[model samples]
Target chain A: MLRLQSVRKHYDTFDLDCSLEVKPGMITGFIGANGAGKSTTFKAILNLIRIDGGEITVFGKPHTQITAKDREMIGVVLSDSGFSGYLTVNDVAAVMRQMYPLFDRADFMERCRQFGIPEKKKIKEFSTGMRAKLKLIAAMSHGARLLVLDEPTSGLDVAAREELLALLQDYLEEQEERSVLISSHISGDLEKFCDDIYMISDGKTILHEETGVLLDEYGILKVDETQYHALDQTYFKWRRKESFGYSVLTDQRSFYLENYPDVVTEKSGIDDILLMAIKGERL
Target chain B: MRGMLVKDFRLLLMQKQFFVVIVAVSVFMIASGQNTSFIVTYCTAMGMFFSVSSIAYDEFENGYAFLFTLPVSRRGYVAEKYLFGILCTGITWLLSVVCCGIYEQIVRPASDPAEQVLITAISGLVLFVPLAVMIPFRLKFGADRGRIVMMIVTALLFGLIFLVAKAADSFPVLKQAVRAVNGLSGPALSGVAFVFAVLAMGISAFVSIHIVEKKQF
Candidate 1:
């Protein structure tokens, strides 16, 4: 549903050459440290920023060519921005009703009620969690085919995060063709919800893998200095030096598990993979 | 565009108290035997300012990032602001004129109202010129910087006018041209002003659309 092919954007101190794809009927999670160009990538895909090079296509058309009619098919939630805080929930509803032809106002109000978001209060007066919920609800309310969520789960407590993630799952189930490209600091949230993962660092896409492959095949093998030198380095994607030993990141976890039984091998999560991809040295 | 209109008008409604105060002040001035023309000019200017302030509100707290994400195109957004400005400023102009007309009919039955109304109506058209000019600057520089730029622009405009007036004083041909304009019939003069306001707003809207389309969130 969405594709970015070597999309490049440059700044005084930072540069981005990112590429990722979100297939229909899939949720793609973007993982990166702060200032790793995740937000910049999202902005580029949304055409909110000018890209220096490369192509971005959404629903088979160039992003720049996406008209208001085409935009109606995409919903977006930005981490640090939303509707004017001076507006109340009812005001947002009124505006949404006018903006989106297929906006489900009843479902939106119901979702707001379910989340305990007061309809009368100005959005500025809302708590952080409340605001996040409102942004998500508004994005989903319009029968959008794709959702571009940048840190949608930020500022939410555990329960709120779970609820929002569950809501996202439900949103995907509602339409087979629908897709999501989400970025979040909470790796666990992405691990649980995403179908695939894309890791970026220093403005470049370093790794892209299925979530299942990341969870099941990727592993971190910790070994003492002697054991590290003795083991085969061919399978190591990257490695880092720890105080106790060398921590080697390998995509072929089973090979390390069978051949080097003495080395401590632990399943890699999204965070672990990100740490290795960003801070580790390539073999 | 309709959605934008709804949002802008709703934002304007948030300052209902300001609207009330403006109306109350105008009513007080008119009732206290202040110049009736004051209502038209004051209310119309306030209306224009209110409309422009909505652009600032949209940009507040990075609001444009989310706003542009919606189904709003930059061109549509610019067009909507111009339409909203006209609607808002025109409404206030009408209200103030009606208020003045009512006061004259009820309290000063012997006074000739047509000439005053004509002058006030012309003032309303002239006010559109600034509204037209301000929107593009606000779109380009944002609200705070836009205000500073507007002040400078206003100063330069006055300076240019002063130079022209001085030139007209020294040149008989220029003075005759000015006199010829002034000598036109009232309807003809008003028509000229109307056409000028429309042309200014059209050019301003085109410029604003270009500015916003080139903008990055």
Candidate 2:
């Protein structure tokens, strides 16, 4: 539903030059470290900040061409910011009623009640977690087909995170045309939820692949220094030196296991793959 | 845009102290008052500034980031602010004028109540709406530096007026122009002021839309 082509934005301390896509009926994950241009990319996509270069489109139309009517189809949640604190739950619903023609007030109130949010209390008096949850609920309560969530699960507790992720799964399952593009620090959740994952570093897209292919095929080879030197460096995708031994991340796990049975080959998760990709040396 | 106004109106209603101050000031001005115009002036000014307070709340605690993420355009947001401000300033202006008229009829009869009401309403229409619209537009700092910006703008405008008057004393042409304007009929003066206020409001809204669209959250 969303496509970014050579999207670039320059800041004083950091810059973004990344390209990625979120296909329909999929949950595409954006994984990166803090200040790694993840949020900047999100901002640029929304046109909250002006981009220096490249094109961004939502549902085939350029972001600039997207009108208020077009924007109704997309929902966005920024982790670092939120709605006015002085507003109450009722007031927020009232606002939604006016903004969206299809705003489901009953469903929104039901979700709020299920989430234990009080209707009369001003949101300013709410705790950090509560305020963050309010934003999430507001985003989902509207009948939006595309959700662009930046660090969506960061503010929640473990159970709340699970619930939110579950809701996202249900949302995707409900329709084939629906899609989500989310960035989060919780790699484990991304592993569980994302169909395709994109790893960004230093404001660039370094890797993109299917989550299953990455987890099932990609492997790490742990070996001692002497053994590492003796082996073929040509085969290892990237190698990292540790105090005990050198760890190599490789896409050819089967080859490593078949040829070099002695070298410790273990299944690699998204985090492990990303860290090695960021810090390890390439062939 | 309607959503933005919904949010702003809710914020405005939460100010209990502001309401209390308005009622207290109106009572004092009417009870032991010199003129009912004071009540109209005070209320109109209060309404104009109160419209800005909604912006303050919206920008407080990094609210604008989330605000713009909603399905509204930046220009729509600006237009909504102008509309909301006009609504608020209009309400207060009307309420103040009606209340003053009532006080004049019941508490103290004015020599010419109709003329008084006309002047009060016309002054409010010509002065308060443009001030309310433009001042909020110029306040880049939203809530934090809003008062400071308002004060600076007001001071500069008065300074400019003073300089023009001082120059008119030395320049016969300037003096003649000023005299000609002053010598116009009452209705003609009001019409000129009305057109000036409308033009000023339009320009303010146009500039505000440009600035707000370029603003980075």
Candidate 3:
């Protein structure tokens, strides 16, 4: 379990003030565009960057109070963050074994074999996908209770991504108390795996909700100008004009179905919600 | 702490400077032609340089970050570094002594007692004190910038020393004062001075660990 409360950080042109929580046994997807404070938040939580305000806690302990033993339960994978390129996969494994007491050498070697990563090959010579896979192997082999991954699938091919997703699904199924917080640009992967999604924009959380609840509560309604005027403004989360009519996002789908039988209503996808939230447009 | 030390040793094994220091000491021992004092002094200076450069290498390689993330505490890291420096200097000093002993058996067949003891003491103090003072500063700032600052400071100190030596040579009263300071003769006094220097180094090392622990990556 993780909680970030009123965490604020400032740069020359951007400011971050956001709060969120990741409950155990849930896979939470952090979705945002580039430079949307995802990496900053992760860095702050890891103490790689100093926070100007607010507190972060993991497993009920404050960030600073979390001892090295506490960190044993946390596994992290950062995009493009690693050791020198000259190190081979085996070298990395050895180094990690030294750093983590829970590190299983057999599991790590097995993962590398499963992922088709050669132990003797230098990381600099590996493709981006291979590098990502190596990092994932390193993070997962330690039997961590909480996995924090930043764009772990950014460079993978479709097959590799599917394999990774399947692995994650199996991993979650096996461990009931384990939780994961992942940020990715690929919405479809998140849609398939994440139970909850948090949409972040401009350093603030725009929406945070259960995926099923979101789909059940929100609906896209196609209405003509007249019908749009008749609809209550309070019900619209986002609305936009089309050539023939308007598409309105509303929380009460059942009410729209009963009240306006002729209007077309459909379930909105995560991408649609994300686009509308970020663009600040209403239909 | 053991993990960090093992990793540091592995990294040090890969470094060319380690080999360079070894070779330089060997050559110096051979070239000294059974001169025990020369061998000890040369090896001590080489050990000092090697210790400083190894610390620089650790920083350049981002080794500290990885080390800190492990279960080892900040104080432990500092303690390990101090131990490493002392261990390396001791080993190099021992090797030099062995080589000198071997050469003495082959050629001179006699040991100069006063010269041997003086060289060992003076060389150890000169090398260890500078290294102790500089390592914490280097770790705090960085390798390149820290080295530059250290060079400037050393230049200034040497300039002041040169001026004082010149003044003492020209003035009888100043000469007497210098003689009085240097002429104090007792192994007990030297032991006390060595203990004080080691204490200062220990305190500096502790302070360095505190600073590093509070640093935000």
TM-score of each: 0.98, 0.96, 0.83
Sequence-dependent TM-score of model 1: 0.98
Rank the candidate models, highest lDDT first.
1, 2, 3
What is the C-alpha lDDT profile of model 3 across A21-110, one tens digit per residue? 889999999999898989888777766667889999989888767777776788877764754455677776776787788899988898
Which DockQ-derived CAPRI band holds candidate 2?
A: high
Question: Candidate 3, which segments miss by more than 4 Å at Cα?
Answer: A84-86, A121-125, A215-227, A239-248, A252-267, A281-283, B16-29, B32-69, B72-83, B112-118, B163-181, B184-193
Off by more than 4 A, model 1? B111-114
lDDT of 2 by residue, A1-283 (tens): 8999999888888889999999988899999988788988998888888888999999899987788888788888898887788889999999989888878999889888877888999998987777767887888877789999998888688898898788778777877788999999999999999999999999999889999989988999999988888776666788898987999988878887888888889999999998998898766
C-alpha positional error of residue B9 in candidate 3 after TM-score superposition, expressed in Å = 2.0
Tens-place lDDT per residue, model 1, B1-217, is 8988999999999999999999889878877878888778999999999999999999999999888888989899999999999999999999889888888788889987877677888889999999999999999999999999999999999999999999999999999999998998766777888999999999999899889989997
lDDT of each: 0.92, 0.84, 0.76
Residue A142, candidate 2: C-alpha displacement in angstroms: 1.4
| Deviation from native of the Cα of residue A129 in model 1, angstroms | 1.1
User: What is the lDDT for B71 in model 3?
Assistant: 54
Candidate 3 at residue A175, lDDT? 87
lDDT of 1 at B195: 97
Candidate 2 regions off by >4 Å? A229-235, B129-139
Question: Could you give the DockQ of candidate 1?
Answer: 0.86
The top-ranked prediction according to lDDT is 1
* Number of the top DockQ candidate: 1
Candidate 1, residue B1: CA error in Å?
Answer: 1.0
Tens digits of per-residue lDDT for model 2, B1-217? 8888989998999897878888897898677765788778778878877886777787788788888888899889888888888888888888988888887888766457867776786678776554645544444657656667767877898899999999999999999999998898766776777777788788888777777887887
